[model samples]
Target: MAEPQAEVDPKTTEEMEVPSSDPPENDNDQDAETPKKEKDAKSFDLGDLVWAKMSSFPAWPGRIVKPWKNVKKPAGKKAVRFVFFFGTEDHAWVKEESLKHYEENKATLSKAGKGAKFTKAIDAIEEAIVKNQASKSDMESNEQSVGTPAEGQTTSPYHPPSDDDDDDDDIFLKSISKPTKDYSREPMAGKKKLNSSQSASSPGSSPRKGSNSSSPFTKINTPLASPKKRGRPFKTLEDGEVAKKPTPKKRPSTGASTAAPGKKARSDMSFLSLNLYNSFQAHLAQKGETAKKDIKPTEKKIGFIGLGLMGTGMAMNLIKAGHDVTVWNRTSEKCEEFVKAGASQAETVSDLVSSCDITFSMVSDSEAVRAIVFGENGVLDGISDGKAFVDMSTVDIGTVTGVAEAVQARDGRFLEAPVCGSVQPAMEGSLIIIAAGDKELFDECESCFQSMGKKAFYLTDTGNAARMKLVINMIIGSVMCSFAEGMALADKSGLSQSVLLDILNLGSIANPLISGKGKAILANKYPPAFPLKYQQKDLKLALAMSEQVDQPLPVSSAVNEQYKRAKNMGLGDKDTSAIYKSLTH
Candidate 1:
C-alpha cells in the first residue's frame, strides 16, 4: 500500500528471498563434511571380522553377516545392530557398541594362534551359512512343489533335518588342535633341495649353521620323538651316577612230603582212612576186631528210675548221649518204650541200681523216694562200694539228708542232684542241675550231668543242693503268682493283654520262663510244660524248707495258696500257667 507496492513482477517477488533464518549450504562445506559422514558409516560393515561380547559367553571372534535395526523403535533412535556368526552353526544379534574391529585387536588375537582345527571350524561355518542361504532361495522358488502330494497320497508333516547327520561337523568345531613345534631350516647358499623320501630316511642331514636367511614356507625335517612322561623326570645323582636296583633274596626249600617229628604225619592216606572212618569201624565190627586197637572199658552203664513226666524225657536224653542205659518204671509199660529205643529194661528198681554203675532217680515225692531206696529190693539194697546214686527228686531236705547218710553208710557215693527245670528242659537236655554231696562222685558223673542238664553247680554239703532247689522254686512260684495277677489286672483295666505282655517282655524282669508261660496264659490253652500239681508240690516243699530254717516267706505262702486254689479247680493236670485262670476266673 505504501507507494502502491511498486507493482512488483510476480516472478521477481518469488525470486526475492527474505533474509534467511539458516545458513546456506556450499560445495566446499559438503567436501569437508563428506569424510566425517563416511567415517561414521564405515565404523562397521557386513563381512567385517570383529571381536564381540554376546550375552555371557566369553569375548569370541565373529564375522558381521549383515546390518540390522530394531523395527519397533523410532527411526534413528535405536543402536546400530549386526548379525554375527560365531563359528558353530551359532549366529547372534549383537550391538555395534559391544564390538571391536578385528584389525585393531590383532595383537590380542595373535597370542592365540589360529590353529589347524580352528581354521577348519571357521571354514565349515562359512560353508554352512552359504548352504543355508542357498537352500532358502531354492525353497522360495519351488514353493508350489512343497506341501502338495500326488494323487492317492496324503500330506505328511514336514520333518526338519536330523542332528545326527551333522554330528561330524559338530565334532570338528569342538576339537582343540595340538601345538606344532617350530622347526624352520635356513636355506643353504648352494645346496639342492631333497625329495620327501630322502628327507624322511636320512639322519644328521640338517641345514648348515650360520644360514641366517630362512624361507618362511620351508618345511624342516623333524623326527617324531617319543612323548616324555608327565611328572618331573627321575632326578639324577649329583655325581652323575645311575641308581642301583635292589637284589632279591632267595627262599629256603621245605622238606618234600615229610612231616617233622612230634607233628601229625602227612602220609597220603586212602579214602578208606579219611571219608569212611565210621564205615570202616562198622566193617571191622562185622569181622573180628583188629589188634592195632586196644579194647577199652565198656561205657558206664546208667540206670534211670521213675519214668514219669520229667523222668521220661530226662532218661531219653541220657540214652541219646550213647550211655549204656537200663531203665525201670512202676507202670512197666513206660519201660517198654525205652526198651524199644535201644535201652535195657530192669525188672525192678533194685535190679536197675545193682546192674548199673550209676543210678539216677527222679521219683515223685519223699515217700516215693524212700520206697525206691529203702523199701524191699530197693536202691539201698543194691548200694555198694564204687557204685553211685544221684537223687534228682524234689524231696524234703530231711529225706535228702537221710538218703545221703544211708548211701554213705553203705560205702557208696551219693549226690543230691536236684534239677531246677521241668519237662521241656529235660527233653532239650538244658536243665540246671544243682548237686551237693561227695565231690569225687560229682566229678565222676560230670558227663552224665551234662547229658541231662545244660549246667551243674556243685555245693559241698549233702543237703545244700536240695535247699538251693527249694529257694529257686520258691522264687519261681512267687513270680508266676505275680504274673497271673498282673495279667488279670491288665484285662480288667481295658489294656491290651498282648501289648501288656510285650511291655513285660521288654522290661527288666523279662526271662524265657515269663515269655514262654505268658504266651500260654494269653491263649488260655495250658498244654502242660510243667504240671500245675508239680508246681504246687514244689511250692509246698519250699515253704516247709523255709519254715525248717526259721525263714519267714509270706510271698511263698501266698503263692502256694494260689496254686492250691488252682488245683482245687481241677487245673492241676494243666500247665503251671493255669494259675492265671485261678486269678481271673
Candidate 2:
C-alpha cells in the first residue's frame, strides 16, 4: 500500500544553547557577543552552568555530538555554536542544566540517600566542575590551532569545519540517517496501548528543582516510540541511495467519467453521472452553438481522438474545463467509454474533421495516427483550410514532419504535442506537454491542454516534441537498467533481496522507482504500470533516433539490449523493473 503523506513543511534546525555567567544586569553582554566578536572568542567559556528555558515540552536530551567555540568562519566571523544530535524532533530546544558532565552523573545522584547523601552530592558537584574545566582547556587548545578559511571572503553561508578539529572520521563518513519509518505508508489498524502510566510518572513531563540534575532531559528510547502506527515512519536513506520524488496524485474525478465503452463501471463511479448533468446544462447554455458555424460558445468545440490511456485522460480534462468536445477513436469501443460519460463521440473521422474547431490526436503510434488522419476515410478528407489538428503521440521526428506537411497541405493548422510522462502523470494531470508546429494552433489549444497537464512547453518546430520524448525516455531506461545492475550485484554479494532494498532505501543513491517497485520485484509482481514491451520499443526508437542524428549512445544501446533480452524472454508485458529478473536469469 502507498504510504499516507502530509504536506512537508521546511524545518529550521535550532542552534545549541550556550551557558552564560554574566550578572543579570549585564546589558553590554549582548553587544559583547556581536556576531563578529563571538567569532573572535578563542577559548570555550567554563563559566557557571546556566540553563536556557525550554521552548517545547516532553523534554528529551540532545547529545552534544560536536561542540566548538571561536570557530573561524570563512569570512572571519567567529561562531560559538555546537551541533547536537537529537533523537526526536520534539525536544530539540530544551537545554539541560549542568548535571550531564558524564554518564555516571545519574548513578552518583541516586546514591544521595540519608547520611551517605551529603558526601555523594559533594562528589557529584566536584566531578561536574572538574569536567567543565577540562572541556574549557580543550576548547582553548582548539582555538589556538584553528586554520585559515579556504577563501579570504565567503559568498555562501554554509562552509565546512576546519581540519584542526578532532579527527572523528565517523562524523564525515556517516550518511544523514533518519529512522526507518515509511512516511508514505498508511498507519496500521488497531490502537496501541499508550505508556500513559510510565509517561505520567516520568520526569520528562516535569522540571527537576535545585541540584544540577539533567533528569528531565533524559535519553530517548528509540524502540518504544516507533514504529509509528500512522503514516510512513521516517527511514534514513543508505549511503548511496538517491531521493525519490513523490508520485503525482491521480486527477480528481470532478464528476467526470471512468466508464469504458462496454464494461459495467462500479456504481460509485460518479464521473459519468456528474458529467452527464454538466454536459446537459452546458449543451443548453451553448444553445445553437451545437453545430451552427456563426454562434460559438465561450469555449470552442475541440475534437479529440484515440481515447486510450493518454487520450482519455486529456479529453476528460478538456471536457471538464468546459470545452465542447467531439471525440473519435479507431476502436469504436474506446469512443463509447467517453460517449457514455457525457463526451459526444464522432462516428467517423470526416464528421470529427468537418465539425471540430481544433482537434487533438493521441493514438498508439505514427502508423495508426497517419491512417486515422490521412487515410481514405481520414480527417484530411473532411478537414477545411483553417481547421487545426494537434497530434500528441511519441513518434519519429520524420513522421511528425510528414504529418505536419499533410495537414498543412489540406490548409489545416497542425501541432505536434508528444507528452513527456506516463500513465500516473497523465492521470494526475501533471504530464509535461511538449508542442511543436503552428504557434497559433498551440495558443488556441493552450488552455485545453492546461486543463489536462501541469506544464506545457512550445518548441519552434514540430519534431522537437518527438526528440524530447526520446531524450527523457533514454534517461529513464538508463536509470532503471543501472538500478537493476546494482540490485543484481548486491544480491550476488550475499545480501537478502529485502535487505538489499533496505540498504538502497537508507542510502542517498536510491531512486523513487526502486523503493516504489522494489517490493513488487521481490514478490515477482509484474502488473504493468508501464508495460515492459512498450519500454523496449521506446528504447529501440531512442537508440535508432540517436544513430540517425550521428550521436553516440553507448549507454542507451546497452540498456536497450537489456530490455530487448527481457522482451525476448516474454517479459515484455510486465513492468520495466522486470529487467532485474532477466539479469539474474
Best by TM-score: 2
lDDT of 1 at 146: 32
Please write out the lDDT profile of model 1 over residues 1-585, one tens digit for every residue.
000000111111111111112232221221232356554765765455666553322344566552111001112322433333332222333556767776577567434434332343345335434644554566578774533222111100100111222321121111111101000000111112211111110111122122332111111111111011111111221212222321111111111222244432111111111111222222233344331222232378888886654675577667656677888655332343354345766656667777788899886667767777887767888889878899888778889999989988998889998887654455445577889998987887877887766679999999998788777877777888898899999999998888988888799976766776677676555545466777788789888877777989887898899999999866775667789989975
- The lowest-lDDT stretch of 10 consecutive residues in candidate 2 is 1-10
lDDT assessment of candidate 2? 0.48
Q: What TM-score would each prediction reach against the true structure?
A: 0.49, 0.49
> Per-residue alpha-carbon lDDT of model 2 for 57-124, expressed as tens digits?
22212222222221211111232222121211122212223224323443553343222222423443
What are the lDDT scores of the predictions, listed in order? 0.52, 0.48
On lDDT, the candidate that comes out on top is 1
